[model samples]
Target: MAFSNPFQTYQKQAVSTSRPEELTYMLYQGLVKYIRIAKNSLENKNFEESNTFILRSQDILSELMITLKTGYPVTDSLLSMYDYMKARLIQANINKDQQILEEVETYAVELSETWYNAMKEMKIKN
Candidate 1:
């Protein structure tokens, strides 16, 4: 039998059991990680590697946009931000621009921190 990595198994179980809020926070964390890695790849002149990571980041942003509930006022604003980030990611991938990737990373960091704080507050309340 082929062996599966234990960490991958743990991650799959964690995601399957995570609440919606936790999932959102996890997505933000993932987006930030991809952008940072892409930035490093760009700096090293690894254009293909950078493009791959940028695409991953863009995919996560798209998933977040689709999963977001539409009724709330904040949803519109968040959608706009996601659109802007995706556009920047495309531009970064096309031009291999570290600056554009950094801009996207800044947004990702802000979003992740905000979501993490909200998650903590919800846990405290419950």
Candidate 2:
């Protein structure tokens, strides 16, 4: 059996490194952090806190994408998926929808895992 560092293995890899580290790094970090918080809170039946984390995560993603002139490889379907998930997150927050929140939390974890895995393989870091 082998043990590996998941954090190092699953970080997001940006296509270009010309930008400042803060611009490239913190958004991704925030995404990763809030997703975990949301997931954990939902699993614990803490709906309020989970919703908060989801909103925070959405804000981070919105902020990061706002200033990007060069787009990365998050394709149209994925972009639509993000928008849909983000909307569901907001709806969950407004309606106190636990089931939807759990679903979104699961989605976030999977997406983050995929993003991190690719980043790890590409050897990109802050």
Candidate 3:
């Protein structure tokens, strides 16, 4: 996104293009990566690695909200989501449950979809 206006970069996408979908996919990939790391770490009883991935996932979520320019409603929801995700990460670390990591991944995917849809609505086509 090397543009003077970041929003403009998103707007330039072709109507038939897959960039928007790709973005969603990319977010999912990130979620999968982090969650997988989390699962492996939790399975090995590596609390630190699990914690790290959780924090990374949280950071990605924060960046997603900022990128989407989400309004109050979305912002409020994101706040709750972020809190829940962080809590889950901590719980996964403590309980060493791979399932908990998968649950968090589900939330991440949902959030990505929501963010991409919201941004699509706001985009001003070129």
Winning model by lDDT: 1
Better of 2 and 3 by lDDT: 3
lDDT of 3 by residue, 19-61 (tens): 6556655655687688888778777888887888877876766
User: Lowest-lDDT window of 10 residues in candidate 1?
Assistant: 91-100
Residue 84's lDDT in candidate 2: 74
Off by over 4 Å in 3: 1-29, 41-48, 58-71, 120-126
lDDT of 2: 0.68
- Tens-place lDDT per residue, model 1, 1-126, is 999999999999999999889889889999999999999999999998998999999999999999988888899899999999999899889888889998889999999999999888988999
User: What is the alpha-carbon lDDT for the whole of candidate 1?
Assistant: 0.93
The estimated TM-scores of all candidates read 0.96, 0.56, 0.56
**Which stretches of candidate 2 lie above 4 Å from their native place?**
1-29, 35-51, 64-74, 124-126
What range of 10 consecutive residues in model 2 has the weakest lDDT sum? 12-21
- Rate residue 111 of model 2 by lDDT: 66
